[model samples]
Target: MKLQTALRLIYPPRCVSCGDLVESDFGLCGPCWRETPFIEGLACDTCGVPLPGHSDQIEHCDDCMRIARPWSRGRAVLTYKDNGRKLVLALKHSDRLDIIRPAGVWLARAARPILQDQMLIAPIPLHWSRLLKRRFNQSALLAQELGRLTALSVCPDLLVRPKRTESLEGKGHDARFTTLDRAINAHPKRKHRMAGRHVLLIDDVMTSGATMAAAAEACLSAGAHDVSALSLARVAKDA
Candidate 1:
């Protein structure tokens, strides 16, 4: 307790969602924590998209029904706008290690019920140049936390982004999906490890579900029996 107090005195903690100083190191201030929607209620079971006035028994969303995902099922912690983008950007550029703990915990809480029986965790890897520039992979940080929570093995290098592509920054749906269609590949050595296993792919965000879908296809081609995604946030159309 004394050491913790001294540490706080030296460097007070801050909210993960906001930059306000916190009294403790638990990751977020009271109001900001409460404001973060944990994405509950009736969500799309297949892709984790929020549905309006959905019934619990409905097993799929219109998107999932019309177009099938290569993965088995997925979970997303937030609706991928507002504070969600802030959190992802904080970690991506600001070197916010503190956000990882709470974000991971929240992600674990969201994923636990669905992922209780999953076999392994695989974070989508960044391209070499981007990895060097960023000095970290946000997905890997989230994956490590999920691993710690669920006791699942984290394979940080199971999937790789073989080439750097144009950022999906201003791209429309068609362009974004097409960009990711060939962005991912499996590591040769890891291919054997994925056989017959249910792999959980982790990412900071899922926009258009294109990247995760491509990663899932790679996993399937590499011999994973089943694949699923768990993201911190997901982008959606204006409702």
Candidate 2:
């Protein structure tokens, strides 16, 4: 404990985005904090899209109406815009472990309703081929850290991306969905872990809800009682 305090005195906390010195632990500086596009209120119940109105009665957006999502509900901490996008990119490609704690804290607070006694947290998996190239899976990192925060059972191997699919970055909604349709599944041997359990899936971002829908469907087929999803950011795009 004494050594930890001395280390802290030597190295104070810095902003996650800009690396600017800050007073608090695992936080952003004032400017970056203001710049982050947090999705605070009135988001879609199904896909986490930000709703325009202040009314509480509205639940889902148009996309959710046209689409069939397997997950019962979804939650996101911020919009995939500006600083939020930058942070996600940094975490995904730059090995920015510095942001993991603060980001996981925000996701945990947002996912409170999804966390329950029977809940098991799992991440959307990447195929072994892709995993070898990337050297890490951002979703698994988020889920593991979230498990640490909530004391929930985190089974990162519960799901498997057995087949490698091309990057969905520039793909359209339907195209992405097509690519992910059967790409994800519950691990053959670990199916028992998902059976009769409520799963709270974690990911760094939700773009078309395609990935989450595919993952949730896999869990449900494996006998999961229910499935919901949480993410750090949600893509806001026109349907």
Candidate 3:
């Protein structure tokens, strides 16, 4: 038997979320897949939140309309609820490196509409202290995988977080934005990469979009022609 097939026989592919044996690798089982709220049809153009009804014209969600988004466009693979939340948490805190493959594929599909020719792929930067604690940046991993799948140029350190901000957990919307303001900046040595190019920022989740706003603003300050964002999950109020 082939070595690969032998390995599969020894250790069957399992669902990323529930650990149930699945038919294929890097995917969820049928139950978990159904529970995961994949965003589809009539999503907000600015934030990728699922909106009611269908429309051909560009539309923005209420939150996006109220808040200023520095990025021109955005997309997200799943709504932050049920299995979606579980997947994001696993990737972010559980050291679930296995989730990167499926996430990259989903992110690439979501990003297709906003993709521009010769665009640069980057991830939201984590503070040095947090990086030390976590040992890895999930966003960076996702960005690298996404670049591999899309054949785009990936700059892992394109952005930097000079100021360490407290966790946004349990913080109000205004507080979240206040804490992240002016916290992120373009890396001095790599700032040239952003000049005159369309940059795509990747993140594991979009909560209040405060972090994305800061990162997008940094890219714009460094002379990026445009900034776009893609996330594995988006935290929507109704979801």
> What are the C-alpha RMSDs, in order, of all predicted structures?
1.8, 1.6, 0.9
Q: lDDT at 159 for candidate 1?
A: 90
Indicate the residue-level lDDT of 165 in model 1. 88
Clashing pairs in 2: none
lDDT tens digits, residue span 13-70, model 2: 8889898999888898999999998887888887778888787575888999989888
The full ranking of all candidates by lDDT, starting with the best, is 3, 2, 1
lDDT of 3: 0.94
Model 3 TM-score on a 0 to 1 scale: 0.98
lDDT of each prediction vs. the true structure? 0.84, 0.89, 0.94
For 97-212, candidate 1 gives per-residue lDDT tens digits of 77888888888887865784657899988999999999999999899988998889989999989889889988987898889987999998899889989999999988777888
lDDT tens digits, residue span 1-239, model 3: 69989999999999999999999999889998889999999899998988999999999999999988999999999999988998999988899999999999999999989997799999999999999999999999999999999899999999999999998999999999999999999999999998999999999999999999999999999999999999999999987
Candidate 2 or 3, higher TM-score?
3
Candidates sorted on TM-score, descending: 3, 2, 1
Query: After aligning candidate 1 to the native by TM-score, how far in Å is the CA of 165 from where it should be?
Result: 1.4
Clashing pairs in 3: none
TM-score list, all predictions:
0.92, 0.95, 0.98
Backbone clashes for every candidate come to 0, 0, 0
